[model samples]
Target: MQRMIEFPTAFWVSQYTIRFAFQEEISAENSRNVRLFRTFLQQALSADLLEVVASYATVTAYVKRKVALQPLREQWYAQQASIEVSVSHTPIQIPLCYDEEFALDMQRVMDYTGLAYEQIKQLHLAKVYRVYVIGFLPGFPYLGELAEALFVPRLAKPRQRVAASSVGIGGAQTGIYPLDSPGGWNIIGKTPLKLFQMQRAQPFLLDVGDCIQFYEITKAEFRQMEVNSY
Candidate 1:
């Protein structure tokens, strides 16, 4: 079966960098295509390629030399038919505690959305969010397409110090603060898991393309997990 998709438009970003734009919109399909093409380019370029970064709808490649469009297009034509995108990976369950002690902006969210605390919590738990991009801070996973009912705007003034592991919702996206940093997202809960541990073999717990499902935990359980994490 020859699966056909619109080939990405590749353009030069700099003397040594090129960017392949898969699509304009952010969706699961666009991400898969960007990742797939990124993999192909890495293998295709081989020795000439320095690094490749896959984002929501773009793949930026840093290379040793310039690349041609026609050959890459031809290569894509030959390979696209055989390769299939798979989103079969199981969702990683992230334990979230929504206790008032941790949910700093709970009342704000409740007031804006016209929902009670339990409703807000349940709605937040309903969907399995995709890791759309990793930015803002290191290891900060921008999970997205939050349920419309839970969509609340970021704070008018960003917080000076959002604690590490604080889970928050900002507009259409939800994310966690991987470290103590200034942030604007509405804080809904906190996770005990260490998202960024430089000492570990894998420094980041989450990456782009990962699926996350958050489950509620008691404040006591949150404390115990915090203890166990250390």
Candidate 2:
């Protein structure tokens, strides 16, 4: 069965790069539409396609040769109403430790939201977030639509080194740092899971359109899981 897809405004980014623009803002519907379209293009242009990338609201395809706009547009219009793309909706449970040691910016978050630490933690755990787009770092999952009360701005100054698996909230979104890299998202917790384990058959624990839920864990539990991760 084919999915009901909305045709995006297609444009040429370059001679060999074509982009499909969906909605201008980030939302679950837009993400789904973008992913579906990317999947469609991969199959439709298999011979000419080099690579396809999906963001919040756009799909960019790198091709082997220049694809004329008229023919591509005709194909896009013809295929718009029938495109099949499989997407997983099962929520992955991420165990998080929100103890003072790992939550470096918890105080800042508390001050900004005027919510107690317990309230903040509960708010974060209450919602199932969607992986809107993965970027900024390899295997990083930009989960979105965070609980309204838990929303807080990113740090004014990004940290020089944010530990891998550190979970943080920024405005209406939340995400986990997959590697030790500089970041500005307000750090609220840390996860024991290695989000970007290159040694594994599947390098990434999350992907675009995937769902996630966070569960609270004690420091001792976190250490146990951390030791087992290796």
Q: Which candidate is the best by TM-score?
A: 1
lDDT of 1 by residue, 1-230 (tens): 54587778888999999988877898988876776777778778889999988889998999998888798889888876555544345799999999999999999999999999999999899999888888889999989879999989999999999999999999998999999999999999999998998998999998777888999999999999999984
Q: Worst 10-residue stretch by lDDT in candidate 2?
A: 80-89
TM-score of candidate 2 to 2 decimals: 0.90
Clashes of 1: 0
**Residue 200 accuracy (lDDT) in model 2:** 94
How accurate locally, in lDDT, is each candidate? Answer: 0.88, 0.87
Please estimate how well model 1 matches the true structure, expressed as its whole-model Cα lDDT.
0.88
